[model samples]
Target: MLEALAQNLVYGILIGALYGLAAVGLSLVFGVTKFLNVSHGELLMLGGYASFWLFALWKVDPFISLPAAIIFLLVAGVVFYKLLFGRMVKLAEGDKIQNTLLVGFGLSLILQNLALQFWTADTRSITTAYSGAVFSFAGVRFPLVRVASLVIAFVLIVALQLFLRRTYTGKALRATVENWEAATLMGIDIQRVYLLSFVMGAALAGVAGALVAVGYSIEPAMGMSWTLKSLVVMVLGGLGSITGTFVGGIILGVTESATGFFLSLTYREVVGLVLFLLVLVFRPQGLFGVKEG
Candidate 1:
């Protein structure tokens, strides 16, 4: 049982890093813009699919394709901003949420089905030389690719933390997160912040997609699962807190591992929902989120 627990924990943490990557971006978009991007997962799927096609046809490695993926998502984000988000802001935040949710969810369905139509819903994975190597420690075996992806996720979280703490535009995003009304009053272009933040968030999702393509099955409808998981992370971590997202993700990871070990694999996913409720019941503000910072 102990050995099985260890293995589950290992899988959970590595998987949680990817979940953190998903949630952090989703949380940021919600924090500043106050819109829950329901279709955020589809972008992740798009990222994976983007790399898959490029790797298949152009012989490009996804690690190398990361930049192109980021750029593509960034452009896609900006286009969405210009075509959709910018217009929605004229409506109230509540209206924006309703409109964006409808539009984004619609887009997600379209993307998922379209992917099935084009790709045939087959599970696809990248077969790089490093794909099959596993590192064993004590009694468990850890795949190198999963480890690499976890490292990338952690690095991204830290780098984004540093960016938010040190840079000008990052500061603007923080300011916007803190108090949108005051930031608008203090000469910060909330609109620009919204555009940039949304774009950056989308870019983060793109990177996650690339990483996932390295290790997991790629499909059109996979985004819904991820999007739901990210929502749990965001709520548990506190919607506007980057650090909170990390804490929430790690907690969910450990909880999932524990549950999956002792209980049935059938209940593995239920752990996230349970944790979400447990956190909200105890600390509605989230693990690391500040109520009125």
Candidate 2:
């Protein structure tokens, strides 16, 4: 029992880091653009497919293909915002939110169906030569790929944090997020900020997707579920708080691990929903979320 508990803890931490990365992307978009991106998971799906095709066809390593995936998704995100979300940004706040949600949902459905047509609903995975390599200490064994993914996630998160804190454009982004009108009056290019935010968010999702592809099976319909999960993580982390998102992901990872260990795999999702509901009821602002004006 003790050994099992130890194993689950390690698993939870590793998986939770990936969850944090995914949720951070959503939170970043929401924080800056106030767009509830329902199509975010599809970006992950695209990343998975990109990595898979690169590995299967060209024999490129998934890690090696990550930069290309990031760039592709970043460009795609900028185009999406410019073509779709940009037009609605001038609407009344409530109307803009509603429209963005609807548009995102429609985009998600379209992407999912397109993927189904192309990938045929069949599940796929990327299995490199060292995919099954493991590290063992005491009675615990950890997959090397998962460990690598966790490390990459942390590195990316730290890089993102630094970018948001130290760079000129990053400061401009924060200013825009705080008050677009004031930022515009101060000569900050609001359109550029929005484009950068959306692109960064999409790129983060792409990286997380690549990591996930290395460890899990990929399928056309796999994105929606991850989308929902990432949303839960976003809300739990308090909407726009990066630190909160990370903590929320860890909490979720631990909770899911405990549930799966004690009960059945089927009930693990239910517990996440329950946690989300409880947070909504007790603290709608989120665990670490601030009440933004």
Give me the runs in candidate 1 sitting further than 4 Å from their true place.
Answer: none
Tens digit per residue, CA lDDT, model 2, 7-91: 9988988888888888899888888888888889998888888888889999999989999889989888988888888888788
- lDDT score for residue 155 of model 2: 89
Q: Which ten residues in a row have the lowest lDDT in candidate 1?
A: 84-93
- Per-candidate TM-scores read 0.95, 0.96
The runs of at least 3 residues in candidate 2 whose Cα sits more than 4 Å from the true structure, single-residue gaps closed, are: none
Best by lDDT: 2
Tens digits of per-residue lDDT for model 1 on 1-293? 67777888888888888888989988888887877788789989888888888999998987888899889999988987788677776678778889988878887888889889999889888988888999899888899988988888888899999999999889999889878889988899999999998988899888888889987767887999889889999988887678779767777777787787888779989989988888889988888777873
The lDDT, on a scale of 0 to 1, for candidate 2 is 0.87
